[model samples]
Target: MSEVPLPYRVTRVRPETADTVSVALAPAGEESLAPFMPGQFAMVYAFGVGEIPVSVSGIGDHELEHTVRSVGAVSAALCALRPGGRIGLRGPFGTGWELGRAAGRDLLVVAGGIGLAPLRPLVTAALAAPHAYGRLNLLVGARTPDDLPYAGQVHAWSASHGPPYCQVTVDRPAPAWRGRVGVVTTLLNGAAFAPGNTTAFVCGPEVMIRVTARELVHRGLAPHRIRVSLERNMRCATGHCGHCQLGGVLLCRDGPVIGWDRAESLLSAREL
Candidate 1:
């Protein structure tokens, strides 16, 4: 398919957190947007304005979804549009969190704030095929209770079966909230997994990814077994633009989903 943006009609919009909204899209064609793997992102365009890369927040047997935050001119424009609006989309780009590596092994997923959007599909896919992986875990953290995205779903996952064993934390908690309080890394202390057999997937702020990966390593997960979705780096969702370049890595092509061993040096030296 062409990297040029494809026309997509907004089918529905649902506010996630205060600043985030989940928009469902359907391409203006018989082909529709291509099926995307978890952790892959699409370059979403708001007509008349520019475009930005947004992660796929939710996906199932039907709708294509994007959980976008109105943080900039183009993104805000994309968010303000209503359900009947039209947008442009390209990609399903970047390397996705290849969950097959974790098959028959422990899988740990960690997210921070909106970072959970890209990781949600991984969770849904894992749950649908429970016997494929040894254990499933999800840990998420946000600035505050009100900042947590997908709150209801998180609650459901936490209350579900043995694997997935979900845990959520907030930097600060509202008096009305009764969940754990602290940065996401704090939850790692109570995480139950044999580090040696664990394949960990982390997506969050640069600092959080570092801290969490270090914690996972301290507990025994090998660097190669750790996968991370880098911040949605892009200009051209295809690698030609170089705007999202990090030394030898072109985030749009080489990653977005990069192994800790492959990215540790770059994440350490640069402003990823």
Candidate 2:
């Protein structure tokens, strides 16, 4: 992961929600950074504005995608970018979801709101190779129907008729919404998987991750088989900055994705 950002041009810009946009980028010059893994993040520089760590939502040959929510200055700048715009990008940083470990085991994916962005590629990979894994289940939740990103893509995934078994819920429902309504964990009751044979991937608010992982453990899944993605005030993608430290681990360098066996105590610390 180079500290310096490389020039990239926006190839496509699509609005996902009122405050979110998915931007596709390609190398502007000959040089191209190494491919990013599913759960890894890139430091995206919006010209004079500044840079922020954005997870890679999709990855292809010499191409990348980022789903940005307009939460702050840097994110808002990214959301406003147009198709022909230019930006700077660096990295393939931090640990990835490591899907290979789950081979031959059932796959469970849980996401809350924008957390789905980083896990998107993992789901796509699993779907494409149905024979490589056991049953696949995806549970997603958002504040409201409109708050959900990749709504159409998720709908298509669920409509595919089998295997993936996608389900969605909303904390607050709109008048036109007709799906389930509740926190993400509420949907787990219907997910089909044998606890002993399952490997789960979870990403969301810290509280949601904690609750989901604990529930899975209570239902007989081993803590070591559950993986979670975490985020903090990560200023530098390298370990030099202590901003993203949780307990003794630096999220940007050592994590962002870790097994529940290792993350449980760190997340439960009273003075992290």
Candidate 3:
């Protein structure tokens, strides 16, 4: 098969939270853009710095956006690029959290810190087809209330009793904050989930994923039903580079998203 070409041009770049910025890009011309499943990510390349994989944060009319936090050299460079700057993009890759499987069932999304990026596309997709799913619960956690993403949108989602049930938590609460306080896991206690019919998607730091996954399982979610998005050092979006190999799995190619059962080995393996 021929290689898929990168066809994105920066349309707008705006900050979403303290450390994260949202970038919107559209197709360069008449060429059509590839459709992506929620929870999939695109590999973004900055000419001189390098290429890094980032999740699609929002999809707009004629554009797709990515939420990126300044975490490393390449990311800092991405944050520095102005609107209209040229950047390379290569995906919508990885096995996404399958929305089809959750159809007619409840959907639970748990995100911590920057982990919210990958979950955004899934939320959008779910909301678009509200009738297909039973209930949609989104629980997000951040270092502080100010670090939350899509604050206004999340609030509106929560107000509705249907699919998009949104809730937020913070490690430390400001005086004005009235939402749940403590880790994201703490909020799970009172939430109602139909374990047998519900599928949960989690993305966060390793420790947070571990703790959250444990809680989900304890709440009766099947180990295999829990999907998680994993992060590692990636140099090439293709599997040629060895930078992102964890155990026998190549994160860039095999996943960024994997089922809990499949990831169990690596999650417990040493130096993965």
How high is the CA lDDT of each candidate model?
0.86, 0.91, 0.82
**Where in model 2 is the C-alpha error above 4 Å?**
none
lDDT of 1 by residue, 1-272 (tens): 54678888889998888888889988767666678999888899888889898889877655689988889999899779788899988877888899987889988999999889999999988988999998788999999988888888897777776567999999988999888989998888777888888999999988999888888888888998999988644788777877888778888888889999888888888655
TM-score result, candidate 3: 0.93
- Say which candidate scores most in lDDT: 2
Error of 2 at 84 (Å): 1.1
**Cα RMSDs, all models:** 1.4, 1.1, 1.9
Worst 10 residues of 1 by lDDT: 231-240
Q: Could you give candidate 3's per-residue lDDT for residues 134-244 as a string of tens digits? A: 778889898988888777777677677746778788999999988788999987865677988889999998888888988888888998889999988876657887887
Give lDDT: candidate 1, residue 52. Answer: 93
Per-residue alpha-carbon lDDT of model 2 for 123-225, expressed as tens digits?
A: 9888889999999999999999999999998877667766688999999999999899999999999899999999999998888999999999999999989
Rank candidates by TM-score, best first: 2, 1, 3
lDDT for 195 (candidate 3): 88
lDDT of 3 at 48: 79
What residue runs in model 3 are displaced by over 4 Å at the alpha carbon?
1-7, 159-162
Q: List pairs with backbone clashes in candidate 2.
A: none
Instruction: Give lDDT: candidate 1, residue 118.
Output: 93
